[model samples]
Target: MYVQIDLDGPAGTLRVSGHGLPVVELVRAPGSPPDAHTPIGSRRRALLTLRVDGVPASIGPARGRLLRRSYRVDARVGGVRYRLMPCGYEHSALSRDGRRIGTLQSSGDGRVVDEWEGAPDPLDLVLGTALAAAFGTGAAPWWETVGDIVGELIP
Candidate 1:
């Protein structure tokens, strides 16, 4: 399954989709605990906590400068402690055993992209993008659409 998260709009407004179907919507209001409904979350935080379907996955601050910064968030999901490292503008999800699980890519225009090798859970992708946004690296142009990038990558 393919998941896409758009964070190009106002802070706390995120649109999430699985393949071509709507899955959830996520919002992070200023000074309030981030809330997600309709499977919606992460379309938007300060030291944001990565929440998927109302569950916190990773906790970290979106620090450093663009292209030169890095996020070392602590992920506690599914009884697993994972590590997320920034790779350029994209981020990778690794198991505690250091195995590659999947990746969350970003367009210069501000859309969060998801790519993985196995049939990884969609929640993992959402969590990855949510963490990226939480750490403030989710930057994409306003006009880029998730549909536009679908089928563009043939891996």
Candidate 2:
């Protein structure tokens, strides 16, 4: 199965859609603050809300580690707790109860890959892609270096 996440929507919004899946929309909660500190060249963290077919489905925070490039997000979708964390370079593992059920490539194309038999649930795909988009992928620009240096000096 193939899933795609589109980040070209209006500010603070993401769209996830693919064949055989209903389009899911994720919107950043208003007034959500960026993480105070993040690993150099990594994306800043934010909290987001996921909606399926215009109904609130789940909410979570996506955050990056300080001094490391890894990131993770925790959310309860359909009453089942799920976590999305970096499993390798440019990809993230989606797990529940410590078992990885899927992987999402946050880099080029933003594809979600199922690790188990049969296609992944639509909610899992939406939650993983939403978290990935909010947390971002790959290296950030040079400005992040300045921010990191400044953050250290201030604290």
Candidate 3:
């Protein structure tokens, strides 16, 4: 699947579109953590707002630390679970039940690339890109709310 992540904006909004999937827009939630304005905690945060095909949805981190050494965090959008793991050279794998269903890749000159394993949910790709962009900041940071997604849930 073809996905594009746009980060060139003050809002840090991420837009993903392509591959017959619904377009999704992700935005960081307030108090979610690691925002430049906040202090204390890791750069990895789990709260965000996702708009899939113009319908809004919420995604947030689940309690408990990740047991897998390769993965960074576990997040949920409704009942769906998403695991973000590190992959080959600047690439991240977004999986469900240990199966890689999506991926996020970053390149020089500030371009983000993404691909899906099959016909995965568009929101999965959206969440992957949001986390990728958030943690990609690579600077002193803290944990904050990120955001609480609300509105339509893509099926």
Candidate 4:
């Protein structure tokens, strides 16, 4: 399943974090054939608690679920919104595999952050681009259409 999350932070905007502290978003699941590379532990649902720029936002599961090979999540916190989508794929299909959010192309490895350590982070730009693509393509929510000209740093 694809798991995506929008994180609130002092950065002044919505961003994604897998390891900044507190699993603002949890990324894990078991594999078929019981592979040890990935394992499943006792699992249950709990409120998703996060500190957005020091303020806290706890949310109940809203849209996405682990069951879908692909999923999308949109959340609001600290008055800002976050978007997340996770995709599960087979080995053979791994080549050239990526999910498009509007126009920001995300590599399947979930290593999207390091790509934006530089100013005007290309990844973030791409994310906005993805939103624009989706919105313009008429493939996603109408609100995302604003992404075409509006880009934010989440501050």
lDDT of 2 at 124: 67
Residue-wise C-alpha lDDT for candidate 4, range 1-155, written one tens digit per residue = 12244422211123343333322332222231221211111111242233434555532222322233223334345554545443222211111113232223333323232122234333334333222112111122334434533666344
Clashing residue pairs in all predictions, respectively, total: 15, 0, 13, 19
Name the candidate that leads on lDDT. 2
Q: What is the lDDT of residue 56 in candidate 2?
A: 66
- For residues 1-155, could you state the per-residue lDDT of candidate 3 as single tens digits? 66665663334456666767667666665544444521112333444556667766544432322222323556555566667655544576777656788777654223556777876576676666655654431221112112212223333
**TM-scores for all candidates?**
0.51, 0.61, 0.51, 0.29
Score candidate 2 by lDDT. 0.57
Q: Worst lDDT window (10 residues) for model 4? A: 88-97
Greater-lDDT candidate between 1 and 2: 2
List lDDT for all candidates, in order. 0.48, 0.57, 0.53, 0.29
| lDDT, ranked from best to worst | 2, 3, 1, 4
Candidate 3 wrongly placed segments (more than 4 Å): 29-47, 54-56, 61-71, 107-110, 114-130, 137-155
Residues 45-155 of candidate 2 have per-residue lDDT tens digits of 344566766766655544444422335666665567887776555566777656677766654233444454356677666666666665543443336656977999995
* Deviating ranges (above 4 Å) for candidate 1: 15-47, 65-69, 88-97, 108-110, 133-155
As for lDDT, the candidate ahead, 1 or 4, is: 1
Stronger candidate by TM-score (1 vs 2): 2
TM-score of candidate 2 versus the correct structure, residues matched by position: 0.61
lDDT of 1 by residue, 1-155 (tens): 55565763335555556664424444555555443321122222342345555555544433332333234455666576655565443454434436767666543244556666676666556665555444433332323434346647755
